[model samples]
Target: MTPELTRDCQTVADRLRATGHRLVLAESCTCGLLAASIAAVPGVSQHFCGSAVTYREQTKVQWLEVDPDLLSRHSAVSAPVTDQMARAVMRRTDEATVSLAVTGHLGPDAPAELDGRVYLAVCVRSGGPGASRDGRDDPYVVHAHALRLHEQLRVQRQIESAREAWQFLVRVALADI
Candidate 1:
């Protein structure tokens, strides 16, 4: 990791710890890199709830309870699947106040249709009556409303870079919190 990224992660971790917030991660293209980065921080165990590396569709379905039909319809990289994965991680941990989900095709060879694509969803839980469909839904809604980023690279390099990108995003989100 770069110096800036390391500082970002530590900053986010510190804020979460101070706020008494817990986090969980659901990763696909980035594997478990995001989780590992957060875990590297000293005292992060208190706020880092857990993580699931749902790299395969079956794993996402079986472990994260992502709807198989949704996966079939939109593929694993779709916003809905990412949101579902985030929700499942939060539910399983039972203590996560924030959850992050990532899925994407990390290489130029990742099918013409999916080349250089990435989808990220961050869910933050709020305490309130009738929160309505969990806070994961809010992130999904925003995801649908946003303009996504796109970049092209070799498949092998993309996969490796996606991990770094996801970790960077985690650090940013932690800072925001």
Candidate 2:
């Protein structure tokens, strides 16, 4: 792993540990690089719940429950899909208090408009009064952003995306929630 990626993972790991938050992920385009990066951090298992690598539309639909209509409307790499992925991943893992989802088109064969574009979403569970229909106290606060990668090589793009994802996770973990 690159030094920058290691540092990013360390920062995210530190923040999650400080906050007592367990993280889970749903990934595509970058595949499982984000999870792998975090896994490199020592004692990461204490804060990481695991990841769902939903690289295929069928898997995204069946595993993360991403809406087929949303996929048809906005494509798999869109912000809406990542938003759903972030929230749904947390639902799948009872131990996770935070979820991160990333999707992108980083390839030579990607559509011109979508090439090098990535979307990321982070969801944090918080307690609030009457936050759910069943009167449960837990509610989620979600944040989503887009990234444009400048790397020309696919492998470089994946590495850069994973590094960027770790940085995003640090920000989300440190945020007031």
lDDT of 1 at 39: 82
Q: Show how many residue pairs clash in every candidate, following the order shown.
A: 1, 0
TM-score to native of every candidate shown: 0.76, 0.92
lDDT of 2 by residue, 1-177 (tens): 888888888888888877778899999998999898889899989989999999999999999999999999999989999999998998888778889999999988999899999999988776422133354544688988898999999999999988888778777655455
Best by lDDT: 2
Model 1 ranges with Cα > 4 A deviation: 128-177
Looking at model 1, residue 119 earns an lDDT score of 72
Predict model 2's lDDT versus the native.
0.87
Off by over 4 Å in 2: 128-138, 175-177
> Model 1 Cα displacement at 5 (Å)?
2.5
